[model samples]
Target: MSDTNAIGLHQGSASDLAAKLNELLANYQIFYMNVRGYHWNVKGPNFFELHEKFEEFYTDLLVKVDEVAERILTLGHKPVHAYSDYTTLSRIQEDKDVHDGEACVRGVLSGFQTLIEFQREILSVASDADDEGTASQISDYIREQEKTVWMLGAYLG
Candidate 1:
């Protein structure tokens, strides 16, 4: 039998893509919870603004988390679902009790930086594997987040 997966991609390449996507999912899960905490705990003069923005961020992250998990399934692999797995695999650690607006923004910026850099690596691997779907998805995320990073940096300045 041929070595291709159900989706017609080479099994080895699809497995590699799924592995990277799972890592991304873990990071997204951690980041999502962090933003949710930021939304709920933000205080001070900019509380309203930061709270609203954090809600937006976490909402988007939730969608991305689902999409990444589904993509892993499409690749014929299981996405890591347990909170234990997320905590173990994610590089973006939990940010607890960050009530300061600036601190929360900084935390978000750091998470975006981590995700963008990691996505770039995944993009390279996806490109090498000729996995255009994964590459395109990651490319869109990178493009959107580069702009966000710039805006967040401006906010901090």
Candidate 2:
């Protein structure tokens, strides 16, 4: 029998892909919570707009969180689930009680930046592993987020 993972990918490459995916999962969880905080705490003139936007952001993040975890499972690996693990693994740090709309937008921009860069790195690894599923997934995220980074930058200026 061939050395293959649950998803039929080479065992070693799938293991590496699952590990990188868990890292992405960790960052997404923290980012989701940060956006939740921003949605709840944002105030002032743009409250309604920013609040709604943050809600949309968090909701989308929640979906990706599930998708990433499921992908890890498909690769024959357990996804890291604890908040403690998330906090330790995530590159995006927690944002506490941010009420200013501009500040929240800046935070979102920073998150997109981190995610895009990391996703690109993952894409490289996925390509090397010949894991087309993971490569396609990360590519879509990077493409969407690059546009978001541009729009958020415009919002800031």
Candidate 3:
């Protein structure tokens, strides 16, 4: 068995958790910026409605980015804060010049898929590490995002 860290999480597991959290942070940063781009650039007859929706999504993403960075700190790792760092580590990339309503919604759905996958990975590792705080936080995200995926899917149809 691995030794536990000072924070009561397993040392090797905590280190791995921190690394994964950093990856999650990177993805969130990219996703947040992407949504912000969507908010700013979305156009069509649906502009008014989609603009507000994108704003709501990006704002929520910003909060999650902060939470993920803080969680990394709690695990005894510094979060990578630079955009360049995010670009390098993130699976999600910054979307640019995407003004179409349908495209923006598709991008959001794709980003959410990536997010759910990352959170699920984090959940599994957190559970193994016995890190209830991390597990609970990601679990909440997965549930909320799943509902969002459904609602957004309905919007797309």
Candidate 4:
């Protein structure tokens, strides 16, 4: 536990939140890597559009990855960044091979939706724990990922 708890934040076992945060961080890492892969491998008549979009998503993911890790650290937990941790903790599975352009968008949309749902659950747990900071962070993450999902879904259509 941290030496000082934020106001309205109860002194509860951070074990559960810590575990969830680690899982979220791991998922984010996998998602980011996959986005990067799409950015590099995307090819088709829509190449310019899809490739640029993938780059934008990857940039957002990079920022989000840092934000989540920092939030974990703020809670007095060590953020998981290693490949081993990501592989074990992440639920997001990587594509073995690049698919069609539309399929790539679908894949990313699936990932974003999965992440949004997981983060929403974590936020609920944080709220129940009376950890306002963590809850707020989860809300922010959910909002951002939800927007990403919408954009990706739109691209798929």
Which stretch of 10 consecutive residues in model 3 shows the poorest summed lDDT? 1-10
lDDT rank order:
1, 2, 3, 4
Model 4: how far is 16 from its true place, Å? 1.4
Best by lDDT: 1
> What residue runs in model 1 are displaced by over 4 Å at the alpha carbon?
none
For residues 9-124, write the lDDT of model 4, one tens digit per residue: 44454667878989999999998899888888877788888898888888988898898888777776789879888988999997647846887788789888989889888988
Give all candidates' CA lDDT scores: 0.95, 0.93, 0.92, 0.82
TM-score of each: 0.98, 0.97, 0.96, 0.89
Give me the displacement of residue 149 in model 4, in angstroms.
Answer: 2.0
The window of 10 residues in a row where model 1 has the poorest summed lDDT is: 1-10
RMSD (Å) per prediction: 0.7, 1.0, 1.7, 2.3
lDDT of 2 by residue, 24-79 (tens): 99999999999999999998899998999999999999999999999899888999
Inter-residue clash pairs, candidate 2: none
When sorted by TM-score, best at the front, the candidate numbers are: 1, 2, 3, 4
Q: By TM-score, who's the top model here?
A: 1
